[model samples]
Target chain A: MSKKIVIVGGGPAGTIVANLLTKKLKKEEASVTVIDKTGRHVYEPGLLYVTLSDQDPKGIVKDEKDILNKKVRLIVDEATKIDTKRKMVEMKSGNRFDYDYLIIATGARLCPEEVPGLKEAAYHFYTVDEALKLKDALEKFDKGKIVIGVGGVPYKCPPAPAEIACFLDYKLRKRKTRDKVEIHYLSPLPRIFPIESVDPIVNKIFEKEGIKYTTFFNVESVDPKRKEVHSLEGETIGYDLLILIPPHRGSKVIEDSGLGDRGGWVPTDRYTLKVKGYDDVYAIGDATDLPISKSGAAAHYEAKVVANNIASEIKGIESRDKYNGKVVCLCDAGNKAIYMIILQSPLVPDGSIVC
Target chain B: MSEEPKVDRLIDARNTFCPGPLMELIRAIKEAKVGEVIGVLSSDTGSKRDIPLWTSKAGHKLIGIYEKAGYAEIVVQKIK
Candidate 1:
């Protein structure tokens, strides 16, 4: 019988792993399977542009079937649970898949409901649907106070909120409503970006753009009717539209499988990408709460390391692939772009780098 | 005039971030002559689905796709 490899979550990490594995295995050696709930794969980073109505939403999303390797079985369903000991996964559709090795790539999801009144009042641009909704809202509103709030730290794409703020500034100006609409950026961190070194550059950009910046203002709750956001620091900001980057959490399946830490992210050897408790199971992307920012690029690099290690283990060889926690981010600084690089050691030690 | 030999090329983009693999595939295809086969190896969930769709719309033929240990290899025959 051929070796069966099952990958959960058809995001960047899972898909990348599946593709690489197919290249290594012959037709009779191994069979790869990928499972995802959605049929559409959206370019998540493009959401910032989508929210500003700068990019066509359709261009950012693609059909999942079109990307899968012909050899891999693409299963479209929700993964309800993982039975590591039994080496099987139970799906919401009541189908169970048995595997010799399992890779979890289910990325993070934004949970606005975690904060009171946020689900009802605020709009999010984390997903394709959310971005489209935000685009529509922004286009319809003539002139009003637009508040861009950073719900908490460790959100995916650290620079997204700031990028969106800058884009909104330009958008409002292009609409000739700059004088009427006020844009405010609220964050819990002391500076625009947590990394002290990068703050000087980011802070300068914020000032040059004329965006009102409030630091150390932790959002407590939101009142939709009053269009107000109350912070734990005893300050309130009122706005006609709220574009929020909500707190992110790990997959519920990972938490329920007992593989997650206190924050619900899978705990793994930062260098190995191996789940702490299970040898046959590995986690990648936002599913594993590594110290680095949870972005597609991080997932891609982590997947490379995990794939090599997993391949070595399968072949009865010593695994040598190790993650160095490298991260690269493309910050859209209004009209131009800034490419930032953050190494792993400094990030893990300081825990303030804007990855 | 003689017909150009169809070259079979496989481009692996698995585990590569956005715009990286896609951009590379476009460049590789452009360098190849018509009737040449270009295989893309991408595991970025988005690319697995996007490449074929884009290839078909761009007038290319998808030969086959297969998955190995951790990535997917998609073969495309450039027609235009």
Candidate 2:
């Protein structure tokens, strides 16, 4: 009997592994099935360019059919729950699929509702629509205080807030409104960039770019009527325009299925990418509670390791490939310079680099 | 063949972000004549590869790519 491997999610990690598995094993050897709600694969990082209206919104995504070749079977259904014990997956459309092995790559989702008055007052910079809205607000503003704050902790792309802050300086300057636009950046983290080496480089650029930033301000709530965001410590920052990086959580299906940790992220073996407490089950990408930057590049690397290991398991061979916690991010600090941040085995001693 | 392919539109997308450069190329292509070549200068790291990929995918021809000190100029001719 041919083995069945079901991958939950169609994000970068899921899509990559599905392609790899099909290419490695013949259809008669093992079959592959992918489950995802939306049949579109979005290049999420491109949304930032769309915000500036430099890119078309329609160009950011590709149809799932185009993403995965016809060789791969795609179930355009949302997985509602995964019963590891029974080795079965249930979908929202009331369909069930059995799998000999499972890979969960359902990435994180934003939950801006965690903070009161946020949805009404501020714009979350995660989606294409929100980014465009912020861009529109930027275009209309001639001058005023713009507060770009981090809602809480564990958000995607930790440096994105700083990038926006610096980019605002350039954007406003290009419009000859530099002197009028006062950009202030606030984040809950104790420092600008969590990596010690990276924080100073970012701070230097922030200082040179004239962006006023304050760290350790955990936003507690927002007051749209007053046009202010209040921190947990009762500190408040007034804004003419507000851009927020909202808190993120794992997918609802992962949380509902009791497969997630306290933060709704899946618990997996750091080196092997195997789901903790279960055999023949693995997790990758943003959904896994891995101590690494949740970025697309990182997910691509994780997919390679996961696919190789899974192929080994099917062939009854010992797998040698392991997921090294390495995350490399490239940032353009608004025409000044491009910097790269490299963090390797961050949970271990002395394993981070920033340039 | 003309050395420059009769450059018609010049897009100054330098210092802009990714997809920004690509978008500028697409916009210029849309406004230019079918055979006119559009040139875009971009500092985004992704543009060098992205522009070429997009040009091929859109059924257009990439005229040339010139790399400067900090940025690159990608030229494409709208084929269809």
Candidate 3:
């Protein structure tokens, strides 16, 4: 009998594995199935562009069925629990699928409500609705003190906060209101950017662009009525406009099934990408608690390793292919110029990024 | 099944992490003549499973997989 490979989540990580499996294994060798809550697949990186009205939102989304391989079964349903003992996934619609191998790529969820008054005051661009709303807000605003920063760490796309700050500066300049608006980039970390090497470059750009920034400004709460942001460090900053990247957590299924850590991130083997305490289950993308940026590049590289190894297992071959922690990320510095950072291994210093 | 296939080249990839072993095997396979048998010793548990798949994918013949003291010896013959 053919092995059953079930993937949860229809993001880049899930879809890449499913498509690659279809190519590696014949129809009779193994069946690939993907279960996603939403049938729609959004190009999340495009959300940045959507926020600035750089691209049409319609161009970045597609039906899951349209993108997935025809042989791979697509189930548009919410996975509620994963019965590891039985190797079955239970869905919200009372449906279940048994799998010989399981891959979790549920990605991260934005929790704006985690911070008091954050959901009411901040403007974020993580989702379609949020991006569109921010776009509208930016279009209407002429001048204000725009306080832009992250609400918490471990959010998807680590560079997004910095990127958005630069984009905001560029936008205001385009409106010829650069002198009127104050752009302050804030962060919870001791440095503006997580990567030490990249932080210096960002500082140079922000300085040249006349953008103010502060580090270690961990958010305590926001007072929408007072138009102020309170940091745990006892610092209060008032903003006429606020753009904060909301805190992120793993999928609810991971939390509900008790399959993840406090932050809902799965404890996965760094090299093997296998979830700890489970031999047959693996995690990729934002689902895993790997200390890497939860970017598309990270997910795509991790997916290749998972797909290659899983396909080998099904083909009666024990492949020793492991994830090398390769991530190729391109950052938009605005002004129609961008730079790429390719990290072969984040855990080790390879001197991979060049300014 | 007990008799070990004769290999023209041997690549000891012990203590190497995945893709490392598989990558060495591929490079060795390329350098060897078409009919030469190549064996790769890998301590990476994943490589034991990955090499065989890669050999087959590359249209090479997997002779056999032998278990060693702390590593796996995977033998593959270049077919084309």
Candidate 4:
């Protein structure tokens, strides 16, 4: 029997899973259709390099048609609602897709406005546009108190804030303005990183780069007009320039479909990558509230299991691979120090990063 | 037939994404001696244009580009 696999969102997880299926399964066995609104695949990890002036922003984006396999039918449309019970998806464009199996990998959507005045007060480097904007802003910035704020917990790319701090130091040094600038960073967690083995190493980096760090400082609000940010605990900090990683939520389609938690992140079985209570449906990448880092690398791992398991079921065989929540993060601390951390996570079973 | 330019180094960048292949080629070129032929295997669609552009910009010699199963082998030689 042939299968219709409809993958929503052509980000890392969807694109990789679609590629795996199209490459592994015969065209007669399955038809893969991937639907995404943007139809552009951004290598998000590379966005850091763009901010550092090491990589071109254009280099990080790949056309969806170029990355997805030729056999995979690509649709550039917004997935408005997913009718899980009906095994169908309703798109904003009014197209309907029926799926024997579905994979939701829409990833996170940044919500800077969640923090009062943050949308206007600070620059962000999460999206291609935001990153390019930050690059332009940095180029004009010479000497000032620079602040990198982690808006809240459960943001994408755990090491990005620290990396940005170090990269800024490196940049300032090159500009001969190191003495004129002060870099400060804050993490919602108690430490710089969740992994025990990686925390101390990251601290060494903070010390080496001379960047100040404050732990357990979850941002509560910002006063863009005053150039100040207040923590949840009421601690206030002033900055000349602020770069923030905003709080993010899962795809609205998942939330509208009532398949996600209050935070809008879908719940998936950590090991099998299957959406809870949805035997025919699976979720991967930042879209799933998996107990691991919400990163492209982790999505690559989860996609392997989802793709393989679907293939096995279609072939009437047993699946052998499962996701173990393993995440490998290469934290690029400027000055050629690339800190590496390998861990089994979301840091703890409760999915909280307990420093 | 003219003998194919001898490749002193071959980089299998297949399965590696954008910037991955380019970064690897850069490292190989840095380690390579002048006049050494370096061949980079990339599956990334962007490499065809990226590598050649980099080669020209970096003052390296681009020998030839060969298509193979599932990837392209971009051959270049290190110069001054």
lDDT of 2 at A215: 59
Docking quality tier of candidate 4?
A: incorrect
Best-matching candidate per lDDT:
3
In candidate 3 chain A, what residue range of length 10 has the lowest lDDT sum? A345-354
Error of 4 at A355 (Å): 17
| The candidate that achieves the highest TM-score relative to the unseen native structure | 3
Clashing pairs in 3: A318-B49, A318-B50, A319-B46, A319-B49, A319-B50, A320-B46, A320-B47, A320-B50
Q: DockQ for candidate 3, please give it.
A: 0.01
- Candidate 3, A189: how far from true, in Å? 1.8
DockQ, computed on Cα atoms, for candidate 2: 0.01
What's the number of clashes in each of the models? Answer: 31, 0, 8, 1
Q: DockQ values for all predictions?
A: 0.01, 0.01, 0.01, 0.01
Interface RMSD of each: 18.4, 19.3, 19.4, 18.8
For candidate 4, write residues B1-80 as lDDT tens digits: 34567798776655432124554565466556789988988666667876787677566888988887877888999996
* Between candidates 2 and 3, the TM-score winner: 3
Candidates in order: C-alpha RMSD to true structure: 19.8, 19.9, 15.9, 19.9
Task: Please give the TM-score that candidate 2 achieves against the real structure.
Answer: 0.79
> Candidate 2 regions off by >4 Å?
A336-354, B1-80
